[model samples]
Target: MKVLSMILAGFVVGYAVSDIRPFDSLLSSTAEFGSPTTIVNGLTVLALTACLVSVALARSSARGVLVVAIGAVLVVVFRTVGMVTGMFGDWAGAVGAGALLGASAVLAGRHRAAQASLAVAAIGAGLLGTALDALLQADDGPVFVWDVAGAEDAVVPERAIVMVIAALGTALSLYQAHRDVALQSHETRRTLLVGLPLPIAAGVVSWFAGGHDSGDAVWLGALAGMAVLAVVAAFALPGRDGRVLLVLFASATIGSMGFAVEDSLQLAVSVALLVVGAGIGYRWPQLYVGLGGLLVVAGASLIEGYVALPSLSQFALPFVVAYALVSVLSTAPGSLAVALPALFTMSLPVTVFAASYQAGLSLSSDNAVATRTSEPDHLVLSLAGLVVVAVVTVACAVLMRRPTQNPAAR
Candidate 1:
């Protein structure tokens, strides 16, 4: 029952965080806001809200679950209202959903050892949610076209169903937490306050960067700065918070391959692989071994990007990403609120910058009338970033392997 509760919490959080097309639909409805950049920025704000709320409310499970329930209800209400009135329902519902994500993470993180299974469920569900959303909402193109005005309506019923499921899941988890879990009141740490600014700055930079028509230099600089900020924030946080934050940051950086897939079938396969990898990771949970495998797979994906490759090779990236995330989460100590939200926040800029860079490369090549088709230059950047992440992962893994002077800090 306890494990099941954690899994439920994870699934809801994962779904809420990954599913943002409804909000995109809202932005597209307005002529002035119909641009892809506008939609991305709006969605990014919604995600940042989740991260910020998660960090701010990390201390209490009771409060977190209450917020989760309220958020779930609001999602249903706002979505339904949006369908009928065509007003701000989408925005309101998205904010509610974001609250669900933030609060659910707090609840799930409260469960100590079971955090591994919860992490796996959360990540797998998140990938599955993305795939499902793409399958449901995609037009006739290989990529998701977000400019369509009524896209949110297509997923309204689905969103309501999931929000209900999330509510039920939160209730179950809350019950279990009170019944069986040894509840602890974590001290308000100065590190938590210090770490907050990094994500805010990253969010602002990503928002502005998204709106700009500048060259790749701006995007590259932003990406580099976001990476550095993530590292600094990870170290600035204390104990398990820092360790887990670093692991998640590394996992997310290398996991960019999974997010880059476009084909529907390939995406479905990737999601399945993510589930399988999560299971494997939960069973083993060796941080260094998982990081090593992740690094190797990332390198292979980078190489495959340049070479003509079979479609089957694309699935490997999601698997290693899930494996690495669960393995790290299983062993690393920290507040899930800190690590998960920080990862969510930092990823916004990384994702925007990567997409912008890829778009810039494609445009430049198009203008030059290049005949030979190949992967964008961003894969090289991802590969380079992975090498740095690998080094940090090793150091964090080593530190986590040692006994803590204060067990309570965990």
Candidate 2:
């Protein structure tokens, strides 16, 4: 399970690097430094993968062949990342590389970590990659198009702070997961490997959405219906049920992929939603809290349709949906207040800081960026939404304070 997770992280980092530096050559195609971002990220993934494979090799000889094969595969992935261009070629390359990684991980079998170090490797590298990307971002503040040049700013501190919190948060979650698995809880699966297909499909779908018209009513209806099914799957199925998770991921991925696909402004926001869903599954504690978190989202969406809330704020909807699955079936109501910070941070706070830092650094502090996200209404509605969220969270917390209010906990 842990090995697969690590491999998944490595694969994602590889993909991110490819996206970050799609072109092989720099300006005029004469620069000696060819896609510095891609080269660096590729090296990072290679180093991590090699480290993981080395550990596995130390435990057994059978892994040696697997190690060689994986090394060869990584070489191929790195070489082709820039060699390939355009939508079709990129899609094929990504899918092919991901499949190779998946096959290698599966063939290698699971490794026993002396101290749950495997999960830490997977979780840590994944977290660090995002932080590095955020920290290294240029082009004003936290605007999402992170091309590989920028002087650090105030956002750096906030990202660093979040990185610390993420590390501790993941550690706690892993510990609880270990306990659950030790107790033979059904919620703990052998691996989330079965769930990997959703992201691959999502990446492709998101890319497809990015280039085309998704404004047609048919696409909207299809996506909305998928989302409804995804919510239904959350309520009707078990926590670790593969089929249900597949539905949930597909819905969350494609639904958000399609919803924000039409608007160029929503591209970053859409990517953010997909990342949250992919990175953080419906893990413990999050299983029920999603319901309360989503209540705020649904309300906000309705209001946004009329009042024109910033599109970045709309990104929060999927995170809440992913976090706040319909729990009435498996668990009772949960405290919304508990999930408020997480929901907010993962969604709006991220958007705000991205916009804020951009506004503060690149654009005039007095004048907003030309982006729709920079509109004045973003601040006003966002804070009002947060206040409303806080009030709702408190009410739910008070109500769910009783054990009967949260059957899932029992």
Candidate 3:
């Protein structure tokens, strides 16, 4: 019976191979068409579908199902590396990576070792992807940095990948939490902690790695991904997911918004997004994210006011009002602790950097009508903002501090 099954498998494999080979001929014959890649891609998709079907149907007949799937992958990679490189930009590599990811996820489902290993790999992938981008795209040195100032197009694709990874991990993280499986709240927290320092570290490394226009795809990806997480965390997910998402979200928020937005109006638009996000986060248990959204408003308002509004008093006054607004709207009992640090982290770096950057640019000599110097005033505002941050952090720490109560006291 085994010999008969083997003979049948050989015949099936031979037929499949002969049938799938026509793609190359079809591709070559139609080279004069709209896009060779589109044709090849269509063929590849069809081939992939057939291969998947074979894998499914052949499982009961033969043990070579996985080999069939792998062979299909190799064919796609060969086509991609040779033809799709120029058209789709290394699409084969991405498809291959995705295959590996799916495989890892599957392995994780069945085995304990694979589950832990895949978790580590996922966390590392998220972090290393940023670092690799920083190292590779850093063109700021002798190589010469090249990019349109404030370009979002290059960033969009990277953001897509980052978000996919984040979304996948987030989904899996939630599932693991749900399963009472190997991964739990602590693992989720650990993954977030791994995520937090990465962007900052990538920023520094990119500077040294000859990062062009302030780190390439990775930094941008991180920023874009975190913004997405902040919204999703605030609005979409609940409970534990929300908390960890907040931590990861806040990690990327600082020093990001000013660079992410082009000007005051753009910043305002982002603030609006954050406001909607705040509403989402507000209804959730942890008021920290909502407070974080308020912090977003405060920071963006500060930047916008300083740039668009003439008098420092105009922006500063509104900024004060924003602070009051945050205080009034913050609804959680223990939220103040989270709120204070988020405010400090989000506000100080962004304010100081934006202020300094504005000061560096050549001011209009035509502005005799204005009394105070924009550069000096902005620098002062930066200084004052830092001081306020310092005072608030210290005061909050002192105020929130409580002596440990003995068990007997209860």
For lDDT, the strongest prediction is 1
lDDT of 1: 0.55
**Residue range 1-410, candidate 2, lDDT tens digits:** 43343334333333333232322322233322222322222222322233233323323333343444344444333334333344333343334333333323323232222111222222223323443444345344454332222232212333333333433343333333332221101111112221222222222322222222332333333333433332333333223322223222332331221233333344455446534643454234343355445445545554665785675435665455433332221221011111111111111111111222243554546544432211223334333344434433443344344443211221
Per-residue lDDT for 284-342 in model 3, tens only? Answer: 32333333443443454457545875333322322232222222232111111111112
The TM-score that candidate 3 achieves is: 0.25
Where's the lowest-lDDT run of ten residues in candidate 2?
Answer: 332-341
Instruction: Give the alpha carbon lDDT tens digit for every residue of 246-351 in model 1.
Output: 6666665565444545667666676677778877877787767767775775666667677887644346766776676676553222345546644455553333
> TM per model?
0.71, 0.36, 0.25
lDDT (Cα atoms) of all candidates against the true structure: 0.55, 0.32, 0.30
Error of 2 at 267 (Å): 14
Off by over 4 Å in 1: 21-91, 109-113, 134-155, 169-182, 208-212, 257-268, 311-313, 330-334, 342-344, 348-379, 394-410
How do all the candidates rank in terms of TM-score, highest first?
1, 2, 3
Q: How many clashing residue pairs are found in candidate 1?
A: 1
lDDT of candidate 2? 0.32
For candidate 3, the per-residue lDDT at 389 reads 33
Name the best candidate (by TM-score).
Answer: 1
